[model samples]
Target: MRNRAPRSRPLRAVFAALTLVAGTMFGLAVSAPAHALGNGLALTPQMGWNDWNAFGCNVSEALVKQTADIIVSSGMKDAGYQYVNIDDCWMTGSRDGGGNLVPDPAKFPDGISGTAAYVHGKGLKLGIYESAGTATCAGYPGSLNHEQADANSFAAWGVDYLKYDNCNNQGISAQTRYTAMRNALANTGRPIVYSLCNWGQESVWTWGAGVGNSWRTTGDISANYTSMLSIFHSNVSLAQYAGPGGWNDPDMLEVGNGMSFTEDRSELSLWAEMAAPLISGTDLRSATPATLSLYTNKDVVAVDQDSLGKQGTEIASAGGADVLAKPLANGDVAVVLFNENASAQTISTTASAIGISSASSYTLNNLWSHVLTSTTGTISASVPGHGSVMYRVSHGSGSSTGTTHPLIGASSNRCLDVSNGSTTPGTQLEIWDCNGGSNQAYTLTAAGELRTLNGTLCLDANGQGTTAGTKVITWNCNGQSNQKWNVNPDGSISGAQSGLCLDVTGGNVPAGNVNGTLIELWGCNGGANQQWRLG
Candidate 1:
């Protein structure tokens, strides 16, 4: 990652450069090895239970112990669910006699040490939380000026994990603050998995591996399908930043928190396929068996914990049907057919495009149903709305080209269609379901023209507006700067002329309100509404 905030100060710049050199020396030594740091911890994504997504500020010692007990009794412990994390609001408003943050006596009557002992007794790890700022997200005491004392206190309490947050820090450099906690944790001599939760500020993925075991790559996730879709789309575009010891956390799993089963499957499969942390974000003590079944699906977890530790690449994405392929340690490939469409549709992909090159016939193991089948060329499945089908595809050659296609938003099950299918210049684009119309089709040419299949129209910024909120439309194929868009590696489509991003207007809109939301050019802010995948 970019040497993380190089500056004019010679000493600080050298330290930053040294940190970069240390990670680089090893990083280049192995050609993207599974363990970038060789940190001996989080060899795969951290498997755990987090309180905030499930219970928020209502966390208590009893609740955490009960969760630990349920995790043990439900056989989730054997399934690789390890840590039971107490997120924000677990601490008091102030610190203790030694200036160490304190757990609220009333809520955590036995305090953090007792809670950690109880969790550890059940063969589970304990995770504690604090902020890099003066106060946490819930306004609790933070470790801004007391990183060493707080880290030492956590170690004394036998904590096994740490989630360092960022909130109300007066805009201190995130790199400096997070590096402070990293050094603090290291100085404690206790091996705790560090989780950086700064809401992906300063593009944390660019420099996070050196600071923590895993880092959040997006905003928090809600118990809504749109939130999951947004986070999934964002995480898929960041596959290069993760490995064995470090991961790109798109928040935690919301499987049992009232989203649809299809969406839950998408969340589980996408996270596993992408090698994201599988931290359960549900009230485990009261969760139903069905929910645990989804969470502890052995086959899906198998893909996530694979020794290869390679985050799956989006081999194919088009027409709202996406294909993700991850190479496993056993020479087989794990492929996921992700359908972000409103209706169930048959999506297919060939094994060669996914990088499997060996045998003539490959056996497919269904991660969900345990169904086994064989395919000679293409594997296909009927994926449901907002759902996915994952398979372990074996025996195929790795020599083929993948064609990219257009991806439409799932909230409305629509394509990026032209206004009334008009060929006229200045015809604005709108969302409509895919009917294979020529106006709805687009080809991302090597020269950056999003050309229609009919070969007449190209995407253009309306009226040559160079400001935010400029609507984009289809116009005659003229080679002008306004018609060129860079499909960015960060999953954004930026205008070559204005340097703005093609964005969806509704910022975090309520479910079902995304239809007809104007597509405009805005300053690139890396919002989920602005992210796009070239299919």
Candidate 2:
């Protein structure tokens, strides 16, 4: 926890100072939190349902009421799912005569207050969505300059949560815009949980703790394993920032939308392991028993709602097999053995290696199977393809082992090399002859970073650039998204920040694709220049 000074100073001044110091002294784009939002909410990651992924702009009061009814009948409410959030398109395109946001009468015949009353009567809270821009993402009236008026309308409607989005902002800073809404919500004197949805740009997590109960750490998640895996790789590295009051929101859960049952289970397990918000984005009315089982598993949910409030970190990752461990309040660690491959594989880890104190024996409680077993130290399981095996290990310690290998260009058969073997930040990366040198040995870290030179520096996108021609350089590993990479199955290495592939400069042409060619970020084509093999 960071220490705070007197509140006599302005907040923007404080935000600027902290951002500067964090960048200059630590090489980090975000400053550590002085404290999370003091609203006394979101002590645990928020678990609920949001209508966006499944319904989109089709949200209506009837849909929310039906969802709420099903949630209660399906035993989800008793299982700790509380909020029924209505996403965008709930309000009119224009504000009312009094400059207040108006609920679409066609959609909400009884108005928002009536909808909130109906929801509250069912023992669940109501959540609404708005944007901090000139217009909402759907082109509806936004709260950019009418923060107080919009916030007042939400509160007057008895809203308990607000999902503030990012769209159509006319060149304002995220912090300034979000802070204005935070202040407006506070002035309403309502205990509304604030969620910042800025699509993860601007390093929101660094300053998110002081501004909102939760901040998005990535773009919207789709209902597919690839999208979920990419988002997970990006979010798992920033475990140090989440706590009771604020969390790293990786968008919403995509379970029951379209993915297979195995993938759905993996999504739930990983999200719970990371202590992320479990806002369901599926239409619950037609949910299957398997989907409900994955959502209502008390033991798995326990790990997410644990009072420890610690986000899990990757303990071991290699060859598409990864392990994550979250320390629970009861002195047990929740371990997830995930397989990202297309075939079944056995994953293993030791109790002592996961941070548990030495013990005579340890108990492994399988969260999905509800089976209890004893292990002296070794914890292992057979996980199916695109699936996960989670366990609660009592008395354990963990270790991380990253594989160091040369990334060989698939076309030229040359190695990805650090220029002149320099360890300095901003040193260019290139392709060289396949020589077994330390400069050519890159370690893929649990944080999704490619680190070389004994893990001191990372492969970074030049100046956080997202363009096609951004230079790929070596810089100190600072836990920023620009340093994260997704080594995809098709042999393409794409940056988490830009979604651009790492390419060997001029590799498309045989003449310029030779040794000593510099590397860069480019559009992901199936060409050999963008393809790589790690060995």
What TM-score does structure 1 among the candidates reach?
A: 0.68
Q: What is the C-alpha local distance difference test score of each model?
A: 0.77, 0.84
Name the regions of candidate 2 deviating beyond 4 angstroms. Answer: 1-31, 395-535
Model number with the top TM-score: 2
The residue pairs found clashing in candidate 1 are 317-535, 356-396, 357-396, 357-397, 357-398, 358-396, 404-535, 405-535, 414-432, 415-432
Models 1 onward score TM values of 0.68, 0.70
User: Once model 2 is optimally superposed onto the true structure by TM-score, how far is the C-alpha of residue 72 displaced, in angstroms?
Assistant: 0.6
Error of 1 at 72 (Å): 1.0
Backbone clashes, candidate 2: 11
Candidate 1 residue spans exceeding 4 A from truth = 1-38, 396-535
Model 2: per-residue lDDT, tens digit, 335-420?
Answer: 99999998878999998778877898888777764445577999888776888888899843332227688887755667899988
